[model samples]
Target: MKNSNLFKITLLFSAITLSISTANASKIDNDEFTSLQYLDKVTTDAFVEENKNKEFYDVIVGIEDDQLATALLTNDRMRKALEVGESFMYKGQEYVKTEHLLNVADQFRQDIKSMLGYDFHVVQTFNDIYQVLVTTDGSEEKEDVLKNLIQTGKFTYVQENEQMQLMGYDNEGDNKPMSVVNPSITNDRHYAEQVYFARQVDGYEGAASIEVAKQILSDRGVFASENKVNVHVLDGGMVPHEDLDYAEAVDFKYRNHQGKATDDGVIWVKKDFTREDDQYVSPAFDCSGFSSDPESENATSWRPDPPPEDEADEWYRYDTNKGLSLNSLHGLQAAGIIAAKSGNGVGISGIIPQENVNLVSALVVDKCSGGSADIMKAVYWSIDNLESPYAIGNSSYDGLPYERTQYPADVINMSFGGGNAMCFKRSNNYWTTAWTQVVQDADEKGTVLISSAGNETTTTFNVSPAGCENVMSVGAIYENGRPTGFTNFGDSIDVMAMGSKVWSTSGEVVDAGEFDVGYGPVNGTSFSGPIVAGLAGLLKLADDNLTPKQVVDLIKNGAKPLDVGFSGGETTCGWLGCGAGAVNFENSVRILLDGEILGEPKATHYLADHKQKDDSNYISLQSEFNPNLCSTYKVYGSVMNDKYEDLEYTLYGQVGSGDYEVVKVTNNSNFTFNKEHDNYQLSACNATTGNCSRNVNVELDSSYSPAACG
Candidate 1:
């Protein structure tokens, strides 16, 4: 098996060793927990013994759910620091160093599993945060646990789990099946419009695909009457506009770097104009807004000035393309594929044309072409203020290094990656480790981290976090559905999507003078990541009952297969980096509708009904009685006939409460319905009434009970 598969298998065993219980909980009578210190010493000694044996997986922890537990979870002062901006201070801190504590975390997770039964699976975990997953089982207990964790201070806050975050629901926000509608009759409005391959235009007026989006929705029976794709130019102001001929007008607002509400907002206009006339915005390509002159002696763009205008300059220009602007091109291409409207006589329609999705622009690279710590600050800003119902964060930019801190998002799309390898055999870099931790922690908190397999003229190493198993790394496929020439290939890559010749939104506005030129084609796996993100969002909207792994599995299973002749005729295994194949949107919907999306069925209903729940949102349940076969039990309750009324005592099995022939149920009340029995069936009698009948199948399966009549 390959490394990732091996790692996954190993992780399962590792989790099991963490839950080897040492002592019984009932022995500790007092809340003072006098046994804790002894337990702590025992735990420390166990870690030491395991260390001596070099048994890394054999170590375990002794747990006490007393004051120490509460202290670890809810220290008001530590909470305050975290609530403010002091999380960085605890950068390298570990809450519990004992091996037993780690074991306890894993054990508590297992308890949750036992209570919720099979549908809930544990996805990922970091030092403190644990992501437990749930599907359509939709039990009341799941909500109880989520809310209790918050109140008890186990977690600061619990948003919708990553798979269901911002997903579409019933009108009352209840989790239910989503209905598809024709886009033609839908509301035609967008929060922002993005133009890919942006070129210089005189003003913000430029031809875009927003019109295409509107038309697509219109064809689907959804009516888009207003401008849903809002377009704007942000330099230093909230530019306000009211009229839009082709697309939509955008109103800009400003906030501080930390995303605090601010009053500074403006509308970008021609250098010399004072009025808001659409035509007055200048269309020149001059870099004048900068404090430093573009033509100054020491100006810093991506490239050095057209040096000396000589043969040497030609060589320099060839070696380094001056202002080729691949980043801008890449970003714009992704935006277009997502929201460019159709029918304005330009561009293709996007996946979500109804304006149910919104795009936010936070500049990480300044005009001087320098990146600072400000890039991450912009990330935080986007998290704080972007108000779209669903936010798909796409970044074609990567490099530098980062600390392993929490990044909040329903989905984060990364198309740029290429840095260190994470293996014991390879020498590790701190920067790479930190960045990997970022991916790990984000995933733990229910964020789906999507990344691109970096492009290569030849071949370089795979990106670190993308190569990490938990991430959904993607690669690019050309229009012909083959792996693109420059696309990176790797085992860590989870899927492939259209990337080459892809179109997207431009950051420049119509008034910026490069409006018309902004719309065009670009290629790279970076663009592929967002396409997957958008699809991921749509899948989430369709069925909130999917776990992250199930979602990934669905995408892989739903992919359209390509001819695997390029690498070799090795059809089965060579496509690891390409992940099952290219994403197939239409087929995905079909599969979801076919009921393939329901989670793993419980082995027995006896395991399903027993639960323990707190006042919190997530519920927990314990088995009411010992599960034993051949034990007689008696269950008493009224029966409901096919007609909606109650009936007298019906012929069920014998009335022995704890013996081999009968089962006893204590939770049922006098008004409750007795649907449980060893042998019960429904029989339609004559034309007017139905009779209660018994069958042998009831002895084999509890579900073989009589059906209730209408």
Candidate 2:
């Protein structure tokens, strides 16, 4: 819908007069827009003119809410000028174009250009927001241009585009030798190396139990292939790998602008890049001639030859050491973790079976860094391409119109974050507003958004997207069930997952000097986030109607608390800092299959003798209950020390129904009507989750005596 209005303006505007005025400069009174403390002003007037023709700065402008309605209405004259339908649905929403709104927007654009003396181009538009790239042809400084745009009161906010980075850490230094292998985990070639799925590794029990969950689903007659869910990975481009399956892959790294002038006297023509002849280009490092382009021939003949084939596998592992690297296969690695091909006798298995997921690769990152505008565009694209409720409609972009993708994404995995950016509204940052709006839009569609909690090892207080409300932020945990040293912690994190030396598909050829393998180890919260995302996919498969909030709750409710100081060690992790706990995929699956936790509450009963004030002996019966990781237990039922003689005298205390209360003998002593009778009945229920446990009957050991109570 927004794109339609932008297209109408581009075609209808041919030329316009410019009027520069500084009278409205003092009109910037909105605290939300004026309180931006992060933006630094450019003080050097000479520097602005020095680089006037050499640099182009991208600024994002948010249109005020009042203007959005005027921009959406279509008029008779404007309808005839565009020669299109009066109203139509785009991405499941209806929009109408108007000439009055275009004129107003065009006038504002002209006034800004006149004031700055610089060329402005609307690179992209979404939800009444504009990402305009300002070419440095004008003598006005960049900071002054932003202030002038905000002073008009027509825009909600205006700020420079910032940069974001992939959250994964390539821990190649800790990589294991290719020759090393463990066969105990599974038949998959690298299952053992994927320690995140193990029940217990290195004396710690923090595994996600992915294999166990899959088995549970199979036993319940729910086959993996029955799962029909789409998962979109928003990261660097995914390369062509035999271990991964893709429903669609699009690159937003480059956009070609064909300098053209609109009616507003503004040049605005930028088209998204398309692959050459629909050929798939691997984003991984090229080993052929050490060039980013694998097809390129080496200028010099000194490039090393590709690696030799392995005798056992009969497959050649390309030489990563020989080529110039393009970008880290961050997206590919994350995809492999989420939905790599399973049971094909190839690399490791994904958390979700390949047949169960339709992986959509939306490559927004180029090299290791990405601009905010590109990331935002990718977000909009992913949302728009989802299977819509109505018949898909054609939308125009830079004069070229196309149909939307029918595939829908139930879960979007953003394994990247900007630690320097804050997503809170109080910060009064435009980036925060932009991210929050996008996340809210995704939430409205019931799409689960999961992002890494960052790897700064501090707190996620200032992290973007992760800190945004309604987003499930995941932290990293070690095999020993302790929070990873590098994982950002605090109240913002929703849950924890294994992220230490995780083994997954590598973009570059691993072990180039020894052997060729495309799989290797990486460390970061980036990988941890995908594990939870894959589990969310499986949950969606179980129930398609589950909302994003419900999905997050299921995972958190089924998680196991971390073993902060196991074996009486000094290590400790607080509940607020460590998250809900380590995600247990198997437990989460069982919770979905059954109404409550799978196991019963553990409780023990003991008998002892106590001496009364008069030196008389009385038998004491005590019951103790221990809570499990999934929930807390509340013991229920009455305890009768002497069932036959003391029918009227009983030790009974029922804390409020379903309340978390400890049930025990009152005052550790009850008047004994008959010491010979010491039988009691009790049951426990999960106080935290409201799921009850089975009842148990206990009797004191027949050999025990009153002397033991001293």
Candidate 3:
């Protein structure tokens, strides 16, 4: 408890930008309180008595810098956690030299045994920290040992490891049943109708958007090539799914994660996925000393017995699933949405039908949940093994993207989100969390980050990665055209997609975990987010040079307005609104292809979304969304009509509620205001022209009077 240098450690933690979390995150109850008595015992007595039990606890050790990181890599108190090394990514570097690592690993353990009478070994290492599994005497709590160690001031933070659960649920849906399958729905040529959003977009005016995108791409000779896009699915391993084709994998279990998972210290692999003898040896699989888990069992084959009376445990067996495991179903279902086989007439269609997308599966989160550290490792692996002109990733779960991975990520889809957890918070330098900073770093690299608005039926800011700046957060809409009942909304969500009762392949359907098989229906912002991801892949495919900023614009502006919320009420289109509305799948692609030709309204012209009113004589013009009468602005004898009067802006103010009717903004609306009342909202439209912008609330430096606006 003597943390004399705690202040220094805190400052040092902030200065080093490796994106590690130092939150005092673990919780302990009094039942474990008795262990502290052992702290006063001889170091030898603690070690000898603890070693007698031969049980080891997984330990997380936090250090100060890369130098300490490098030292820990060679420290004895740390031993390789798993017998065999799984690929390890720390501070954005990969550690695969097993012989060297394990050799030094042994030496470090011996040194700790001699110096401190503690039998411990390293399981994982990062540039700024390392993990070791240590045996503790019954007298001292594992948490107590970690706590006292932190007090020595040699570390930034320490705590017991945390566990994760899969983020999935049975849809119990009726709209898109699992039992029925039609050839047209399954056929690649006619499967668009089976997909809720793949066909016609409700919000965008052009109903033929998808068909138009296909035709335009075809005319340009742009075809679907599995070789083109790289999509990483960081979930349970992709089981042997039939509808999903061309999936590559990197087993992220074992390695530093040790006892938490079934760690055989081996990454699993498949022949077709790792075909070296074939002409196009897919550059997708990880061959860098990393392999796959043994293999996963077909969930369809193992029907759990009828008796809840016979066993008191919950489990399922699989070859690759480490026996009774929460194997690859959720991961597979997500993959199906992105790249299921098309035109085979056996299963439901994926979003990018006809295009064989390269799916690089990283089993980062086993079952449904996993830690940020494991996710960081998988991201590094993907950056290394799957970088052909770069790629995008699909995270059906929520976690921060790594700030700096060895490779580039073009677009990352986080289809999962919720309120803040122990793992991330701005007070914890939320941005510095490797999970958060990585996305920001990816953004700098032009990697567009996409997240779910959440399913909490609340504002998205309550969520983490979604509310993080610059992410394309998505919400959900039901099949009947209502916003999904549980979808979280607010300005954080950029668009919506068909999420309720949409059919796709089921990973658990195959008897032997093979492809070309099972199908079912699902619901969630999870599905909505991926549909956007699939579209994003298409955007990158159509034009790889699309910047992250441009991607956000195309997605938001091209969407059709929903005009309603999950509660059957009209939606207020503002900073607290559900964004620009639902995803217009076809209009999105069309907008991308049309580029500047469309001359859509620009957000740039309406500066001051964050304009400081404290010093301004007159604040800059307010924002307005205008659809020109002509392709360009119409010119009649060099005179433009003041058409905006027909549709006016309603300005909401600092109170966060109530509306103020604003004068129609033609080009820009500038108003001189008292700094005291600078906080106000603004919105505009050309109702006659059927074009409008969402209501925007601006917080000026101060306040305003009615006369100031005129």
Best-performing candidate as measured by lDDT: 2
Instruction: Please estimate how well model 3 matches the true structure, expressed as its whole-model Cα lDDT.
Output: 0.46
Model 2, 532: alpha-carbon shift in Å? 1.1
lDDT of 1 by residue, 131-160 (tens): 232322223343354443334333333322
Q: What digit string (tens of lDDT, one per residue) describes model 2 on residues 1-710? A: 12221211011110110111122222332443222111111111111222233445556667665564344222111222342224434344664444455555555546655765554445445454455555544344656666776666656677656556788865536565332223445456877788777653333545777877887777655663466788988886657778887887655442201111111111211111223575423323222222111112321111223323432222223222111112457787888899887767878888877777788887665443565655766676677732211112434432222234455679999988775443566544432456767788888878899999988877786787788788899999877678877889888888999887788887453321121328877889999999899999988887788889878877886777663465755444664487778888876765555433322222222223223412333222221221221122222212211112212212222333443333343221132222222334333332333433233343323343334333
Instruction: Tell me each candidate's TM-score.
Output: 0.39, 0.62, 0.56
Better of 2 and 3 by TM-score: 2
* Global lDDT scores for all candidate models: 0.34, 0.55, 0.46
Q: Per-residue lDDT of 373-490 in model 3, one digit per residue for the tens?
A: 4554455445442111101122111111122333244566555443543224334321134445445555666767676677777887757567767778877776445566777788
What candidate 1 gets wrong by more than 4 Å, as runs, is 1-327, 342-346, 365-408, 422-432, 457-461, 504-518, 544-547, 561-568, 571-576, 597-710
Q: Tell me model 1's lDDT, rounded to 2 decimals.
A: 0.34
562 Cα displacement, candidate 2 (Å): 3.0
Q: Over 4 Å off in model 2, which ranges?
A: 1-51, 54-56, 65-102, 110-120, 134-152, 177-185, 200-206, 255-326, 385-395, 398-403, 427-432, 507-517, 567-572, 597-710
